[model samples]
Target chain A: MLEPGQIADLTEQLDTDDAVAIIEDLEEHEQKAVLAEMEPEERAAVESALTYEEETAGRIMQRDMVAVPEHMNIGDLIDYLRKNDDLPTEFWEIYVVDPAHRPVGTCQLSWILRAARDIAVSDVMKREQTLIPVDMDQEEVALRFQKYNLISAAVVNEDGRLIGMITVDDILHIVEDEASEDVLLLSGAGEGDINEPIRDSYKARVRWLVANLATALVASFVISIFGGAIEQMVALAILMPIVASIGGNAGTQTMAVSVRALAMNELTRSNTRRIIGREFRIALLNGGTIAVLVGIGTALVFSNPMLGGVIAVAMLINIVIAGFAGIFVPVMLDRMDQDPALASSVFVTMITDTMGFLAFLSLAVGSGLVSF
Target chain B: MLEPGQIADLTEQLDTDDAVAIIEDLEEHEQKAVLAEMEPEERAAVESALTYEEETAGRIMQRDMVAVPEHMNIGDLIDYLRKNDDLPTEFWEIYVVDPAHRPVGTCQLSWILRAARDIAVSDVMKREQTLIPVDMDQEEVALRFQKYNLISAAVVNEDGRLIGMITVDDILHIVEDEASEDVLLLSGAGEGDINEPIRDSYKARVRWLVANLATALVASFVISIFGGAIEQMVALAILMPIVASIGGNAGTQTMAVSVRALAMNELTRSNTRRIIGREFRIALLNGGTIAVLVGIGTALVFSNPMLGGVIAVAMLINIVIAGFAGIFVPVMLDRMDQDPALASSVFVTMITDTMGFLAFLSLAVGSGLVSF
Candidate 1:
């Protein structure tokens, strides 16, 4: 609720990095006004941060960091730290750099605190560390932070020189965003922000619904081909949707699992085939159980065992196809460098719907339960 | 990939908290074996961590952390830290404890480093901090950490005495697991772990498919009630899946948004009505867009404007109902203290499918496009 001047004053008291987090979320004109209202030094840091593409390491990282040379002892480091009033307002680790300014090691604050005054920085610091590239996507950066359990890591530019640091707090937001983002994207609810303007929400959602409508047309086309059979036997129409519904549900289940696994990098090149086999077997068990329950129910309701058999077989076939389509579509999209969650649902549904209808009706016609 | 003995040896060099992570996942017998092989002190710490319920703050927390009294001067605290060789291996902040060992404030290492030797700990410490309950669910803990941007937090027992510490690295796994978990649960794919046993996978997936089969019966029963109309005008059958499919898609989109929003605490009682209204408007726009596309396409393809009009109106009505169901079902489930993501999809799809058929067929008969 504060005005731009108040925000600017607040930014002056905060670190440049924390200040950028606030200003970067504002509209471009608003950001400009806030920058104009801020102190020049803080304004310069905000401006430089704004130059990076949205959701990059550079954008989320704090430019102010403590990077010391490898030769500094604990006593000298503490002396230097106490002497400097202009250091980063928040930093948990120190980057130990070589002469050319590239990081050679990282020293946790605890390690420095626990060490003797005469110990060399190189001797005490961990040689192995995760270094985030400046232009790396924030999602990837978050994954690295999670994987390595990093509270803070050195952000290196193209030349491998330390430029800034990214902390755990920064990655926390992106983790929630990226994780929730998949659910939103998979469901075709773009951004899924409740605060989003109705126009924006409407635009993104309607586009997805329309794309879905086009695919539903493919299912419609399959049904239309069996119009003569449907007219002769109304039961086909009554039972066909069940097959499609079951298939759609099965496909979605598999697709959700595949999409998440791919996101986590658990379904990788080495084990894709194994995972595919695993999905196939799960589908078989699921398809069998549904076929039994649905087959008996349809048979008793219609007093026709042949009709029951056909629908049951169709359910089995369609669900198995759904399982394959679910894993394949997302894996294919991911291999093509696309977001598997974004378009996998639409494609999987189309395949399941089309196959579900085609299998049920075609079996009915071929079995002479309904003739064209 | 290493054997249990090698892992045991490797864990010997790691912190007890890290060692527990390795041992906690092993078979019970294997965990016992690994614990038996560890040094008595490390084993005691690891065994104590294992005593808490899995996925609680205590289970993930490390027993080692540095806490100092509030009145301690920076110079004295530094001397104490130098004298004490045993401290948490990885920690970013120091908790300032009261006389009774309850946390009163927190001091970051950076703050400690920048201050003069004469300053009291109270002067440099941050008074406001996020404290975690020892027995609190890990997921809730993760949410709190993400919300507050905490790298480390004090875990206090029921008496508000500091018991342990939770670090960011511990939370990262939970965050990823939780986010991926929603996707799996919503789709009725239990656990969804690629490495899960095939028998377990089959048991979980088949149960869901069978439940879906039972719901599909409700849709089938609805379609059966309108069999005569569908038989008289077979085009109705061809076009019905399109309406139902679109409704299902719309419902899913809304449900995903609402479920995720609810999970993130974005949709509270205060904003529930606003979000509901927002979704209603979105459904209107999405439904209208599909009605237009489907209507025009149906009229051109079938040469029946009345039939097209019927289908279009049906799409709009059914989708709007779907939108309502989508938001209401999850919101209600959440209010009742259920995991909305677990069962919302099934209920939403059931409503959409049954209503899609009832709306389309009822409209066709009501408008005299077909006769019962």
Candidate 2:
């Protein structure tokens, strides 16, 4: 989108990999033109990074890190750091590297500051450290960082030599992005970026709507079978949506909770039975509360006690079913190595809507509340 | 509920405030009994923290931090840290304080380790360090930390003297909590925790269902008005729910996007018009696609071209309205200082359901498509 000179000027202000990303977005000929204007060293680093797959640790790590010889004394380490102006300006820990360049240990700044002047780096440094594999998925890397509460971790190549470092600042963005991704995907709302291109947004969203149209047909087929009961009593038509909509809302509530629990790893096989029992009990409580209110209200509005009783039973049955379907569907999806939140709402709604219609209409017909 | 001895044993492993929180959850008499058993120093610190409201920075910050006088040289600071066995075991930076004990600057360990022993601490310390107010809400503190990419920040009292510190580890919990809160609140799904007590879960979820029921009544009233049309043609009853449910799903998709954009600060007044226009265009495309698919399928199933045509036009109209209500309602809520995600689903469904019914049934009645 820009002239070669403009790209060169802009890329100069960005990190090497970031600059390479912008250039790569342009035509192949323009990419070469932009790279040609960069310093040879900068060009090489960017080109090397461009070879890594996107969203991997290799693609995101900063190439600069403070790695010092393992044999240096505290005083000599300080002197070396002071004299090396090319070293990174900001770092939390100094990596202690062996002769072959693999990280042997790490010395946090706190340890260095607290060590005696004559103490050897080997003695002061902590021998244990979490190392990030160069080709690891960014999400897995983030999970490791979170598990260890890491401020920064060294990234090593397949051969185990230190290549770069990944900091908490970058992981912060990844965590936020991943968390929001699940929430958006639940609603079939693609990435949900307002600034995304119209074409990209349509491409992401239209297919989901099409999928929804398919699921909604399931509910419609159920409704079509209940046409006789609905035609016999116009009141059934008035009340059908209320039952289905309420059931859908209840299902969404339980689904939201179950999805979050699964994501947090709080609900596992060890606790699944207990959690299901808990939801079942909660559903009964919720079901009982809603049934009484709707039953009493319907009776007053329609002046038919049997009609009210039929609806109350239908409401109870649908709500309990909603609770079960909400947790069961997501758990089943998760067991199959699928993301529990993805299209969960669509499936949950399908079950609730179908069950809501089937229960209410079947009860009405059987009880002769609305004779067909 | 535990014996005083068990409480004392348990408290030993927890941070002072966390121990106090557990004690405070007990009855007043038991709280006093537990606090009395704590060491005097621990009790004093816990009592001071208890004075701050829950979920404030003061309640969360660690009391231990590395604070040094600004006049010290790098060698002197290093010696002090080495000599002080009572100082915190983990620290990222040393706060350089003035005579009044107010933080004047911060010296990161990396900078200190890289500096000459003869250099004054102030010479190497960063003066523009982030300082958090003690009473700031944890959420606001989290936002500040995220915006600045801070690993740790000093917490200052009202007098601007350093009191405690908050680390990125704690902020991780806050960020995750806030993100999940929005997702759960949007669904009106209480704190959907698998471990939440049945009573607590029931209390949280039922109120939302009750609110939804009230909204569902509006749709019911609308359907009640179209009773005559539905009785004359059973097809109207079968088809009505399809229109409303699809429209509701469409509204949810748009609402989810707008709410997330608002949470991320991606959609603001400056970009509101552009974003709204983008959603509007996407809606037309989505509406057109859905209308065609549903129209073709319905016409073939019912063998009534006019009936399909009526439903198609209704689908188009309702979907466009869903797009508007989804973004419009959330935006207005945000403008009025309400959380855009809270209760947004309820209001959006109400609008979509009403419009879907109004457009389809009104058309059916006027067109005499169901006048058998």
Candidate 3:
């Protein structure tokens, strides 16, 4: 219920982290107001982090950490921890660093709790520890966490000195974000977060729509080239879409598989030929089965056996084309360093829609079922 | 390199666990052959588990676990573990169970390693432990792993008896599989895996193509209703696709967002209206911006201001439709207990393509740019 103005006042009095929590619970207007109220300096830090794509470690990592010199004894470490009133309330391990502030080992909380008070920090600490670079992608970070069964890891700077620490909590966000992003990309949407504003959503989606529009036009233009065929035989128009629709769908299926394979590092140069060959074979099988059904259906609908034969042949051609475009388009896009999921759908649709119309209409005209 | 026949021979000589490992490394043919070679009783046990969908806890759990009586002490446990030669090579915790073999407590390996030999298991075992059900889905299992920061968890049966055990390794596979599945579904494809055989890939893709074909036919039929308009003026046909393509792409973008929101539990009954409104507004804004550009672009390309105006208006209408259909289609599918990712793309494409064609073609006919 807090108004925007009220939230703004709260930020002026509270810290950024505390303000973030408060804003999270408030209405959108209030959150905006509080954000607006912050002085540019205070606002910039939180805003800069907020500017980072959500679900990244930058968004989830805590700025605070406890570091100790490697030379400290257990007694000295205990004194330092006890004296520091602002230590993180919970931590599973404490980092031990060299004089240069680079971590050399880590001591588990349990080990520290159990060790002799007079023991040196180096004596109790385990030296073999995994270190995470600060700029490493969050997904890779999460992978490391999973691989090593880590509770927390040190985030080091370019110089390999500990700058902060990233914990399981940060990884949790990254896992969720990365998972959600894959889902969004596959669907050809911009950052599809529910929290995004209406205007932002509109802006994000419109570009893709425009792209779809261009592709759809290509399909229509292809059909236009055979307009005489459609006018000569209404049946040709009725049957034409069937070819393109089937092809488009088949292409999508292949595109989805290829995009996923590429994302998972499963589809690579070594397997590209194999995957394409597999998709082509699948398209043929599927086309053969569906073409038989659609052909029979078309023959029945039109009461013309010749018409059904033409549509069926067109269906087979379109489906094969769909399958080819589906796998190849995504694979090519991925190879070109574009996002396979983002661009593949548009390109695949263009190929399927345009080819489907051309195949069905051209076949109809060539067969004299529709005379120009 | 291991052939199916050779793997089958190896399975016969190895224990069940070893057989499972060997099968995992074999080619698909080899894996099937080995399973075929097993005795019916042994095969039934393994096959029953294989029947559970891949990535589920049922497929991932180890049938063997070390369950001890609650009465056993540190000295007794140590002696038992030492004498057991066939135990798993790695385990972090030991379960203490009741007479019925239902786990009541767990003790970490490190605790056991450091404890006095004579300490009672009951006194040292942790009473509060998270237990996962055997049938719990893999995604849920990964969530639990992240939430509790678990190293290992026990899998239980319907009656709450310990049936098997799940470790971090199993959860890792689930995380990867679930993530990949979500991505594939969003792109309108069947299960996608790099290791998947080409034949299977073909079968999975062709069905979707056929479905897409059916929908595309519907759109084409709508266009045929206005075929006279296109025949009268080729310009209408040339411009129609531009409008439709933009709309379809826009719709795809919105649809992607909606599907992701639905998947992440971000868009629910509580926020549906808000999200939809937000998306609608965003669509309108995007439509307005793109409308201006496309309108200008068409005008320049065709050298006809009226045609450009028609294209721009169609673009706006089509984009708005795309946005609405994108969110609504997924939401409706989810409500019907269907996976939003699998069928949503097909449905959304239908909406965009149909609306795109209808809007552009109808507008052209209505504007008197083409005579029917």
Candidate 4:
């Protein structure tokens, strides 16, 4: 590891935000030592940034923004900017604040350049600005930027006083990480990344496999209820997995779609019923198609039309039920304020696996193809 | 069902890019009709945007950017900007170009404001830039914006001349969409969205289920090969699915990690072996933990120590094989220029399902726990 002076020397060459990011990742004592080695102004900036928790707007916001009083003219604003050497190297917009430092509006660079020098900043500024709360999660910040097509937004503290601003450049990587997080979490792959430690990977994945064990046990218990039927008609044993496999796949498909929709905020209360209804219609089509294909194949292979009919009806029933469970599980989890992606898949799989077994075995007995 | 004139009016009230997006979503004839009703200049702009394929840099790039000759001074640039009435309402940077209109550097709005009037454009501009090709895919553009931490980048044609510019604000949505696309595709859920047409959803999901049907048959065939032993002992049928279930879950967890890594360009040829080794160790830990739990449970439930031992060995072997298949399938698919997310799951599931059944049932017979 580099010494404190060496680290401080390296960080001093970077932007204050970038410098803070590096020091924040260090151990507490090491960070303190590095901060002590820094210049007072830069040290104070880094320390202020560290006051906020990771992945929050306060942590990513730049303190180097320019905020002018709403009464200032474009000429004064331009003069202030040209005279200040401490300002950030790149900024697309400036906030117009009242006497209390509360942001009243935002003025774009082009608007400033186009307006007459004598025009008040308030006259050129747009009042409909998106303000990010200082402690907002970075993912929420990314969403706001995307939704409003923002170039830069002011970050306000609890009292609604403008503190700093976050630029779109700072948000690009956060969007990618958050979206990828949903995919990894949905698959029961906790925070999946190539650079993740092996022990961490084992811990994350084994916990999921162990959770799946309970679901597997539920499926086994369902199968054991019909163990006598399997003994009497061994062919049932050979073909039973096919129903569960297909049902699980179908459930996963719907669950993936629903989870993605939920993440993007596209599936909301107003459209919940409509989306569910749409999924059901899709389920009917998919179940019908698979039932026909499997039914014909089973009848020809086993030379037993009755058994084929039993499996066909079961396959369709399981698939449609799987679809309902898929949508319901994620939406329910989301409403409960749980991350739908994190836990939805395990529940959806459990439902499909249990239903897949119960539906097929019960149908086999009901149709007189086997006995309990 | 709005008329062409009404549609044109609605689109006219929006930004040019927004207008083009609305027009692009319409059927070709409807789009043409709407375009015909628009003012000639706006219609021409929309038509030019339509020449590029959907989801390309050309479609997303703004043609309204300002480019200036490198020798121009800051004072002249400001005068020209103030004189031009047709400039975009908002722009973060202006490209400094050569006589042939190829970008030599990029001048930020802040740089111009801070520089003295006599400072040449090239003196203040930063030469390092990320220039996007007009035909580059939108996802790739998003990646470049993210990698470079760019606020905006010039879009160049095949001739390496600046055509338009893509801003990070435009890229924010693409990052979310592309990342979400990876998750949806990996689950065999094609473009999964709640608002997607019912017919399209049905078509996408049913095709995946049918593909899964083929994989189900392979599992069923493996079970069929063990039919004699299952007939001799009903316990094999009751426990066989547990092996496949746990193995499949483990495989999916690994596959998700690998696919995300491959997508992010983190797991390249330079680090493939290291990641594979990392996954292998994780698999061992997972397999060992699961084996002990299942082995003891089976032994206590069935009162057969040898059966427990056979299952324990089989489970470990199957889980390890699953880990290999999970990484190899996606890596191999990615190397073939096919989307690893699209087909890796199907192939990995097929392998784990077959191996899970084969290893467990084969061990049962080899250990003389059941007769063929």
Considering every candidate listed, which one attains the maximal TM-score?
A: 4
Report the lDDT tens digits of candidate 1 across residue range B1-372: 666667778888887667777788899988887777777888888888888888898888888899999889988888887789787667899999999999999899888877788999999999998999988988889889988878889999999999888888878888887888889988999998889998998888887887888788899899999999998899989999888989998999899989988887788999999888999998898889889888888888889998889999999998999899989999999999888898888899999999999999999999998888
Q: Score the docking of each candidate (DockQ).
A: 0.78, 0.67, 0.30, 0.81
Instruction: Point out the higher-scoring one by lDDT: 2 or 3.
Output: 2
- How would the docking of model 2 be graded? medium
Model 4 DockQ, alpha carbons vs. true complex: 0.81
For model 3, the stretches where C-alpha displacement exceeds 4 angstroms are: A1-176, A217-240, A287-321, A358-372, B1-134, B146-165, B227-244, B287-321, B355-372
**C-alpha lDDT (0 to 100) for residue A335 of candidate 3:** 80
The CAPRI quality class of candidate 1 comes to: medium
Which rank order by TM-score, best down to worst? 4, 1, 2, 3
Off by over 4 Å in 1: A1-40, B1-53
What are the RMSDs of all candidates, in order?
2.6, 3.4, 7.5, 2.2
CA lDDT, every prediction? Answer: 0.88, 0.84, 0.72, 0.88
Report iRMS values in order.
1.1, 1.7, 5.6, 1.1
Weakest 10 consecutive residues of candidate 4 chain A by summed lDDT: A12-21
Per-residue C-alpha lDDT of model 1 across residues A1-372, encoded as one tens digit per residue: 788899899888876667888888888888878889988878888888888888899889988899999999998998899999878777899999999999999998887777777888888899998999989988889889877888889999999999899988878888888889899999998998889898998898888898899899899999999999988999999989999988998999899989988887788999989988988998888898889888898899889999999999999999899999999999999999999999999999999999999999999998989886
Tens-digit per-residue lDDT, A1-372, candidate 4: 899999998988776668877888899999999999998988888898899999899888888888999889988988899999888767899999999999999989888877778999999999989999999988788888988989889999999999889888878878888889888898888989778788888888899999998998999999999999998888888888889999998899999998888877788999999988888888889999999998999999999998888889889998999899889999999999888999888898898888888998999899888877
Question: Candidate 2's residue-wise lDDT over A1-372, tens digit each?
Answer: 578877887876666545755766788888788888877877787778778887788877778788989889988887788788877657888899999999999888888777776999999888889999989877777777777878889999999999988877677767777778777888888888888898888888888888878887888788788787887788988988888999999999989888888877777988889888888888898888898999899999999888888888899999999999889988999999788988788899999999998899889999987665
Tens digit per residue, CA lDDT, model 3, A1-372: 656666676665643434454555666665566778777875765665455444354544444567889779866776676567665544557899999999999876545544555889899888999888756667667778877767678878679988667666446546666666766665556788779666665555655666766677678778778866766676665566567666766776677677766665668798788877777777788888888988898889779988888888888888889878888887788788777777777788889888877887888878887676
